[model samples]
Target: MLKEKLLVLVGPTAVGKTKLSLTLAERYDAEIISGDSMQVYRGMDIGTAKATTEERARVPHHMIDIHDPDYPFSVAEFQQRTEGLIRDINGRGKLPFIVGGTGLYIESVCYRFQFGQGGSDEAFRAEMQAYAEARGAEALHARLREVDPEMAEKLHPNDLRRVIRALEVHHLTGERLSEQLKGQKKQTPYELCIIGLTMDRALLYNRIEKRIDQMIEEGLVDEVRSLLNRGYGKDLVSMQGLGYKEIALFLEGRCTLDEAVELLKRNTRRFAKRQLSWFRHMQDIQWVDVTDMEKISDHLSEIHAIIAGKLTLDR
Candidate 1:
């Protein structure tokens, strides 16, 4: 029988999710379907923080390096791929683990939001995206609030894509995106246990800085340069990501190299803060504080018990 369970591992950036995910995969005999957006692109490794071959080989990982940097990717595509992966992995007598820090991607799977909604206002979406760039993400969200208060309440003012989408639904179909999600069939094919990992906010910030520094030392700039050399520019969806955007600014002489690095650090920290806010707002997720878990063994034991309890309940 297929083991229909989804073990979702989420946390803010730099909180060390990869190692824990690897350990959990081995422990649960699960296969991982990555929950990251940037990591899906090939030749974007160092900056995207894709796991080393050694790390990923030890635990089978899906959804990493699946696209070229020049290609476009979308949240809709992710949802479709996840639906297939869940079935394939379950058919193999293993559990499916969805792991990463991308809150929207996670929600796409967890809540199984319909990616095919027809209430798409192309003009409004274009306007909102431009507004976010010209004014700010908060300004776009303010526009959404005037149209869809319910969606505005849940989405962060800085979440550019969702804020635009919410406004688009209102302008196109004259219906709320929030209402669209309501009373709809959840597309999730698996029963799930959500795990949230965290550390002290200060400590998490330290780890993010250290990880970015390490990424640079490991040739992040060269990776971006290689992609650029191949003709991808800042306008590509892949290039719009955290690392690429800052590096592109530096290359464009909009900022000094040092300033670019500092901006990367600051922007990543803000992104992590946004990530934390998203995960924290989720009500049913069980959190494991990294500061409290002395060792992987201890952490694994607790997580194992949670999974075991789920199986027992099913029995």
Candidate 2:
């Protein structure tokens, strides 16, 4: 039984995964499938740091801008779409590369995670949703942390849907979703090579700050304004994403613009910390620390050599 080959690139945000991924994909003549949960939505380019027009023109990318901002996309849906894309890319004699910082989405594809079928309690779910609306996502997430620390660690506070589902699973089955996930086999039907990028925490945080400032300059606030003007409310999951939610608060007069930007920076830093925590526990990842690299090209060369040893190519 021949297995398809997959190259996975994952790391915390603002870690220069994008430039490195493009270089690697271009070298291997591969297509990219975004492992990001947010990049799939249309009209979310700047905030998500989507590949630029020239970059996409150079190498085909899949799983980006495929859905409306209000559309619901589960990890199951992401896994299903990624499975098909991998098969088709391999069938066409091209390599498939998965790139993003979304740990669960990436892990679901790499490990072939079988989502559990713990029955739902809609009434309970609604109650939890209302609780979140009243108190806040962070407060709701704290409840999850108490009940299921492992799942809470993986979830962002703003990920209300998954957070509620975790609480609901615990309520209905009297078992933690994380514990149920432990019973599933950790095996994949593909040859997967996962590469993780890392650097000094201080430097990475500086990068995050700079990235947010760049996003603001790139018109992220205007982008949020456009979405809201088109009736995409803050309630939409996409609007609840990092940049969108903060900017939406400013637009809605809930927070001053300065306060919103400051909060965006603070929340984004916290999110990056969580992302690093998730990757730290993952097994079999080749971590590359670019703490001293002055240019992306330098990092690209090191990554290319690493991938060349890990993945076989038909030259």
Candidate 3:
């Protein structure tokens, strides 16, 4: 049996995935499904760098603004929703294009990774949360590193939810979360064409910094403040996202606006590094160097050629 065709564009934050995705989706008659983890929350527009209203008017997008900030969106839920969206988009005789920077969420869909169904321990989860609150997120992450260094390496110390989940997996099943993931089948159920964007490390970092600055200029602090005013606590997973957390500190008087901006820039640079590292480990990505911004049409043509050759799309 033949598999459906799926097109994906992935890269670190501010590597120009959004611009490229819009052009590709328009050219290929595709509907985009956001592979981003944070973009799903409502009212997180400017900080997540979500497509503008005009962009969405040009082409349909999915899996964005579909949840409240307090909702606990897992990789499993992302996979399920994306699969459904893919089918629906394909049924309409259009391509399903996934575009974002979230690595694990995208990879789980691409490879059909089955997360282990170890039952949850509420008390254990609460205790872990308490430990993080008391000793700091790094201290909690250290406990996971003792058991699953590979996973600990992939997850940032500030990603307390996933760190706790990894520890919980070990607590319940005696098997490392990384081991469980490694043991899953690698076969994809699609004729997958993944396009990875890259650029010089220094240039990419520069772009990330500029983008964070732009976000601040575009009222990113106000966006966070609005969310907070609406009763979303800082501890919520959504509030803990890259820009939100740092800016929330400023709003709470824990830091100055300048300090928060600098922190957001620094953390985002590290995040982009981690995103690139994760994507490097995945196989069959047709990497494209997009450092030359002046020749974007040339880059688009190259990507079009790759999609045409790989997925046999009509020119």
Candidate 4:
């Protein structure tokens, strides 16, 4: 028997998820747990587009600003923490709502993925990092392709961390990471519901561009400057996120502000496309088109019916 229940709301970035999620949470008396990878870090509020303090005060939230900027938050750690939160919410007779665009984090918990403790080899990891540094990232990625082509195809050459992880997993287990995941009999420990939001590609891109303009006006560049001024270097993983990294280049005089803004908008649009592609291939998601709304009431009514169908609520 399942021990808890979970409601997941996911979509591409800047797709109005925050507003919609708040409404749903209030209606069901649910507490929100952020599923975003970047939102976990402190002092990253503006660049990460995290929920405002006022909004958070209105409804309880978890998993945001839980760590300093330099802390490394692995997916395994996220899974463990979120499971504990879900249990607590269920025990208290409140719904648990997981809301964000982080697909890997959400999927890991939904499928109850088991990332074993023995997959690390510090010496080997060091060796792989040194190899990439010496031979270039593409060379290291090619090495990964030689062993796990399936995993390699999904990863980009510039994503050295994940590429190194794929290689490390093979070295430690002597088996492909992709194969291990495929062979596992994946199961969910909760009664789960996943809702995905989407709209026309052109319309989504326009929203993304407008959101970037708004973020700039809201001082995203100043936010990045504040973090860097406090001595958070560009080398930290947190600094490498979308808006932070791009704006950092402008602050460094490596690019003009306009160029940086354009780059951010373009990269965000591509990121949104990739997000939609990932969700499209996932199973059991009730997708809602935000463009279909002539009235806010209509959209909420549709969402309410969908959630009511999936969840057993006392109200």
Candidate 5:
């Protein structure tokens, strides 16, 4: 049996995860380690919904502002770093509270899904990109289906990045991606209590749109401008996220601010839908209905009670 408890807080964008996480952490006497993909960048704050400095000070948070926008960080790297930190936190007699809405990142820890051996090959990837361009996405996707049909089913047909990475793993390992992930999950070494935050779809979308508006009011455009002036472009993996991509399109005159904002809202809504799809498959997840609570304390108390009970059962 594992020696400690690792609690995960997961949900979609603009679900008030930050607010709830701070309160939960205080109640459980835990430190927050972010599972967000975009919030790691130092200057990309407004778009990523990174915690404000004052809010971060209220509850010690980790894994935000740890990189420059120009620096690439991957899910595999996040898995490695988060595992080490979780071990350290447990060693110190503290619960590892992994909080954020990035479903894949949280799943990485819970499932211990290995990205694969070695690392990304830029040259091989360029060749594959050319192949996808010359041939068709289906051509490569067919290849993935033969090896990792399960993953292909979960991914969309037009999702080029995931398709390429799935194909790349096969090229590198000569082992099927599905088999690789299956092997990893079978041998996962930890016991986790995963908590999911859920709310009504309409409310979630409204919050997403309002959050985007708030970001713009707080100078999201200037944040993007600074990153570009420092030499990052939309092509980089880190910069290709929803908010940054639309903002870059606006900055480069490809679209009007209004058009970009509309696209951001639509894409973010779609992203939330995808997140719900992803988390719905997660095993042993205890979901807390956020809107059910009348006040913040009620929500925190609900979450705290669940976690406390789970930890006791773990012991």
Candidate 6:
């Protein structure tokens, strides 16, 4: 029994995964399954850097815009949905290509991570939320740092939902979230061809700043304002996403527009660094240095060869 073939493109934000993915999907007759966590939310197009309507029309895409801003989407749900999409695409004689920057989500699908059924304690979650609200997010994060430093390090203090969930998992199961992840098997049900794009750090950070500026110019602030006007609270996971969070602060008068933009750029740069760090720890990635924009065709050929050889693709 052979494993189903999966082609994955992963890299930090602003590393140009989208444009390259379009070309590869066209060439390989693949249907893309978005590996991005944020892109799953509707009405988050500008901030998430979603493929335009024109681009999406060029190739079939799945696992995007399936949820509202208030919906609570977990990594487990992402894995389940993506697995089904992969099977369906293969059934139709098309390759399944996953493209995005979300490390945990993509890695969960790639390695078939089985997150244990850690039942939630509603009271405990509420308590943690109250603690965050009263004592501030940093204080709540500090509590987690005492119990599960590794997990705390990975999560941002402002990501209160995940932080509370982590604390809840620990309280309910008496085991750290990081430990449970380590306990899971690292086996995959797919024959994976994972391509990672990379560039010089300074260059990548510059690109990230420029991209955020472009997002602002493209009405990201108004997009956040619209979601808020529709009654999506700022604390919703979707609202706390990269672009939305920063701009929401500005809209709420918590910061000036310039301050929000600068903070967004800085946070995004840190995020890209974290993304790269996470992907670096994963195994079996064929790295392509996409530092030279003029050599895109060469990079594409290089990636195509990797997929062909790894998955034994005849075409």
lDDT of each: 0.79, 0.90, 0.91, 0.85, 0.78, 0.89
Please name the candidate that would achieve the greatest lDDT relative to the true structure. 3
Query: lDDT tens digits, residues 93-166, model 5?
Result: 67788988776678787777866575678888888667866786568667678888866765544455766787
Model 6: what TM-score? 0.96
Write candidate 4's Cα lDDT for 49-139 as tens digits: 8999999987899999999888877788999999999999989999999999877688888888878834588898889878977987679
Q: Of the pair 3 and 6, which is ahead by lDDT?
A: 3
Q: Who is ahead in lDDT, 1 or 5?
A: 1
Against the true structure, what is each candidate's TM-score? 0.86, 0.96, 0.97, 0.90, 0.85, 0.96
As a TM-score, model 3 comes out at 0.97
Local distance difference test, candidate 6:
0.89
Worst 10 residues of 6 by lDDT: 150-159
Q: State model 3's lDDT.
A: 0.91
Q: Residue by residue across 242-269, what tens digits does model 3's lDDT show?
A: 9999999999899999999999999898
Tens-digit per-residue lDDT, 1-315, candidate 6: 767889999999999999999999999999999999899999999999999999999999888899999999998999999999888888888999999998889989999997756887888888888888799888999999999998887776777888898898889889998888777777878999999999999999989989988998999988999999999998787887888888998998999999999999988887888788888878889999999999988998898789878996656
Residue-level lDDT tens digits of model 1 in 184-284:
56555557788899888888988889999988898888877888888997766678788888888888888987898898899888888878877876655
Pairs that collide in candidate 1 are none
Give all candidate RMSDs, comma-separated: 3.3, 1.4, 1.2, 2.5, 3.6, 1.4
Candidate 5 lDDT score at position 73: 78
**CA deviation > 4 Å runs, candidate 2:** 295-298
196: Cα error in model 2, Å:
0.3
Candidate 6 stretches with Cα past 4 Å from truth are none
Best by TM-score: 3
